[model samples]
Target: MEIRLRVESAVRDEAEELTSALHDWLREDRDVGRHARIGRLADSGGAPSGAMSADWFGWVQLIAGSGFSTAGLVYAHNAFRASLPRRQQTVSVVIEHNGTRIVLEDASPESAARIAEILSGSGDDEEAPGGSS
Candidate 1:
């Protein structure tokens, strides 16, 4: 369960702030683990081989244990969004396991947070139908 958050295209100051916030959050939770800055796309000299400015836009990665459910992943995303400021910005989050990938995006952090919460079951806990927990 290695969680790595790599923030790219972020202004130096903003990136620093984001990194610090992530550290604090991860520290408070035992489920969350190590945080590392593998590399930054902006500092990669030129654009990545196949990543476009639009396609390879800024992103953050959370490497967690294998047993983590998708719901948990969604919860983490929502938590990250909640920590951000209210501003107009496009964000794309990709969670990769083995060779598979799950992507989530939003034009605004608030919307992303809402969607993540719904998917994560951290939102309204009302039962959905047939007495399913």
Candidate 2:
């Protein structure tokens, strides 16, 4: 499984700071460890993006191995949210698993919690006594 959170920052420096914070958070994760790969997003001009007044400079990409549980993902996301200032950050989450892709835009705590429940198969599974899957 691969998870990537792409957030837009106001400026290039903020983007760099966000990247650093994300790296620190991931490293702190017991599953992600300290072997995650980080990189920046580029534009069609082949130059690093997110440099314009409202361009795409606030972009950071992270690559990590699988072994991360749903609960762990939620924890990581929460930690990431707490690590940054309450700036107007627009975030998108992408998860690739077994060739299938899942994308979530403007992911919030509620959405993360729901995703955790779904991934962990902890959602409402109780049947009406006679119901079936």
Candidate 3:
């Protein structure tokens, strides 16, 4: 299954920076990296800021293969948040699966669990381009 993720911050620069940071951070995860990847270079359309990019901005393509754990994904997110400084910790991370969205801010375990649950489900919602029904 795959989900689209984005980082949002009060400042555009922070959002862009955090988006790249989280992407790199996810790639370092043994479990997640094995099954997930960010936008493909061919899908990329360069712009002033990656966060503000017109194509594939801040999107994560997660493939929950055998041995893939939703908890691991959530844990990685929580850990990433915990790794940030207090001020930047408030930056928001959004995960979207089958129309369900889980926003991570304080990296609460409850939120992590909720995201895990979402990711663990049968994620067959193949959104159309522009997200039209």
Candidate 4:
């Protein structure tokens, strides 16, 4: 199975930087790197601050294979967040499935875990995206 994630940040420069960070992480993680890869280069159209772009200002494509685990991704995200100072950063994630896209932002812990389980294709609960436990 494959999972595609679209990541975005409120600040254009931050968006670009985060996209690169995510891509590098996925590529360098031993376990995840064995089964997953960055599907494509992050799409951050070069322009001035207010330039129009695709659905999101920045994007990340997370392609997970059989060996990849949702927990790892979550852990990586948490680690990344921990390294940053406490501040209100608007980072959004969108998952695409069967042509439908689900946007996730500021989700509760339960909802975030549930979404991860769903995306990892390891959940049997059949809960909708962003659903809390």
In model 3, which regions exceed 4 Å deviation?
Answer: 40-56, 122-133
lDDT of 2 at 83: 53
Q: Which ten residues in a row have the lowest lDDT in candidate 2?
A: 124-133
TM-scores of the models, in the order given = 0.42, 0.50, 0.73, 0.63
For residue 70, what is the lDDT in candidate 1? 43
lDDT of 1 by residue, 19-67 (tens): 4554456545444443322232222333323443342323334444555
lDDT of 2 by residue, 28-89 (tens): 77755543454554422322244654444333445654555676666676667665556533
Candidate 1 to truth, TM: 0.42
In terms of lDDT, the best-performing candidate is 3
Q: Of the candidates shown, which would achieve the greatest TM-score relative to the real structure?
A: 3
> How much does each candidate deviate from the true structure in C-alpha RMSD?
9.9, 9.0, 6.1, 4.9
Give the C-alpha lDDT of model 4: 0.56
List residue ranges in candidate 4 displaced over 4 A: 41-49, 55-57, 88-90, 97-100, 106-108, 120-133
Give the per-residue lDDT of model 3 (tens digit) for 1-133: 6776667675556766777788888888887887765452212434333345545444555655676777778788888888888888877676777776666656765666657656766333442212121
How close to the true structure is residue 27 of candidate 4, measured as C-alpha lDDT?
Answer: 72
| lDDT of each residue in 1-133, candidate 4, tens digit only | 5655544555666666666676676677676677776655435444325536544435557677777877776666555545444563336555554444555454457546655666745555432444433
Clashing pairs in 3: none
| Model 1 residue pairs with clashes | 1-65, 2-63, 3-63
